[model samples]
Target: MNSDAPRPSPRAIASLLVLSCIVGLNTVDRNMLGLLLPQIQQEIHISDMMLGVLMGPAFMIVYSVCSLPIAWLADRTSRRGIIVCGLTFWSLVTAATGFAQNLVQLLAARIGLGMGEASNMAPASALIGDTFGGRYRVLAMAVFAAGGPVAIMICYPIIGRITAEQGWRAAYAFMGLAGLGVATLTLLIVRESRVDPAHGKAGTPVATQAASGIWRATRQVAGTPGFALLCLASVMVSVNFGAMLAWLPSFMVRLRGLDTATTGALLGTYKGLVGVAGSIAGGLIVTGLMRFDQRWLAWAPMLFCLGIIPAELMLLFADAPSWWHIGLAADTLLMSAITPCLFALLLSLLDSGLRATGVALYLLIFNLVGQSIGPLAVGMINDQLSAAWGTAALRSSLLIAPLSAAAGAALLLALAARLDTSQAAPG
Candidate 1:
């Protein structure tokens, strides 16, 4: 089978596993800070805004900024080497996070970690796109993307325990060591496939080619209607994602009266098992739906919107029943389910060479607009409302949940119509 064609083969599975590990490791490592934030706050005397910024903008700026260049390199260079190097860099930095003496130092370490983390996604996404084409690619994406949940399940508990007993520093050190091991394995096992001819001959300097390629890929995707809508949907999705991931555990503990251990465990459970199931389900659904009609891209966000209804209710009024446990658990499961479908649609819209840069552009906009603002915005709202509503303020601020979901669904619908209109237009 040609590299560009759709096929099911051993190469596809191998590529899927590698991308899965990349996604899984990045998600787990990034979230480790969330689990340890309270400890870091106590030790560092930082404000909530500062904490939010560190998790949001401070890391994201570097992560988002570097992604395009790294992705550009991935398109023209050895993706395996890029991924392995990225894994090693971030893992080492994650471990180095143990050594911070002040807020500035910790923030700096996170920036380095962000840069390293940025390297993995674009390249890995592109690799999977190349390995598995057409309908099968969606399932491969689902499987690979399922790594995020899998890592959450496996890593959260370990980080929680380490932070609880050994101190946050120990947790950092341990995460770093684990990352190092994974990095070594990646270097040894991930084989590089032949580069596409359009990427130019392999021996050409990657840096020179990457500069031209980045501009070209950006032009292609920017001009493509499907890509633009996906990017828009990504921003809305990030707003929902950033706010929840950053604040949800705190919300659960404060509102439901759960201890950190319980909150962490619950989060792990919902995000781990339910998230994995949702990703796989979304992939399968999209794969099946695309077989009959490609317009499911427009229909996809509606499912996301529907999921938000239960989620918002759980976040807001669900406190009344004293069944906050069930509400929180259910909310988490629903929250985790919608994203894989969104991503599957976006990935399918582009070809292999352009996918990474497209993903990078998506992440760049996603982090700058949504990830950068969403958490801080919610936190500020919580602060203002907290004085009046006290703990209940979190419930109010979480209104973003349903609202963002609805908006996203609308955007997706518009996008589908645009896509159809574009296809009908004469060349």
Candidate 2:
């Protein structure tokens, strides 16, 4: 934070809370299909490969394509306005999912949901950068990151019961209604910053460069230290995220013979509680440790990625429910803890004006390529092996989860080594 900048005010804290809620809500909509997948598959006869597509490309294609343009608009406009509109639009689209009679309708609704969500993340991240600074900035990002876990913890059990009893459509209806309420709350509570990003504010990029167009901003963001390494590592880590988010609940159902309702209830408590704690812990750890070796920002994630591989394997093959449960909890803790570091590291590297566009670019590739491959490839693997192995095919397919962690660890190692040359601490 610049010494001249005003302290983060009460309203600033309030805005962070609102944005964090939006993050949680966005996560719920994205992961909703995952929890509802088994039911949908039984009713609609979607193959495993199609489940992968619906989870990955069907949603991400639109999200990745739209994010940069919408983020460009956000950087130069009222971020609060865009957020309000996105919330309403996506909430409505989410409600419409309940009405889909076929795969085509569901796909269309997913695409619309993606389009609406594309508007929020980049802009909301930029708002966090604008509203909070220094140590608080990293802490704010942690709060934002925890939103997903918090949402799942609170929502999964209810959604599970709704899906099991009232049907999947009812679960979608409940999520959409809850989202609409949050959107209204956002309009009432959050305030946009007075300093305009476009007018060369104190903490923003140079005006001449800004006037040079998006290409210049692109070049600047691309040139950020560790930007390439961060983007590459982001892709690798996201592979694990996509695979787990899309399939983990289904895996529990298939392997343990737990119903969706029961599975959701267990995972909700397990992943959600541990996840929230880990997210906060990572921020605190990074903030405290970076006061010594600023490279702790890079080091923390690299170590966590390596740790996740073994945990994932234990989760996959171990027969004792208690045994594998430890793996599940460990992977969730390590993965959740590391996620906030990415946001902190990247946000620390970019200028305030460039934050939205830059993060959008990073996320575009992370979701477009890595997330797309994780589910679709795993599903294809499962399909090819299903005849010979039966439910065992899913275990074979999910090895991608651990393999991805190894790959991510390698990429993050390169990032940490590269960061060895820089002396700056991430915010």
Per-residue CA lDDT of model 2 for 124-243, tens digit only, reads 988887776666777888988998888889999999999878999999999999999999999999987733344446555583356246777777778778898899998989999899
Error of 2 at 299 (Å): 0.5
Tens-digit lDDT track of model 1 for 225-280: 57777777767877877877887777776777766666667778878888888778
Q: Provide the global lDDT of candidate 2 against the true structure.
A: 0.85
After superposition, the stretches of candidate 2 with alpha carbons farther than 4 Å from their true spots are 1-7, 194-208, 420-424
**C-alpha local distance difference test of each model:** 0.73, 0.85
How close is every model to the real structure, measured as TM-score?
Answer: 0.90, 0.95
The residue ranges of model 1 lying beyond 4 angstroms of the native Cα positions read 1-6, 194-213, 320-330, 421-427
User: How many steric clashes does model 1 contain?
Assistant: 0
Sliding window of 10 residues with minimal summed lDDT for model 2: 194-203
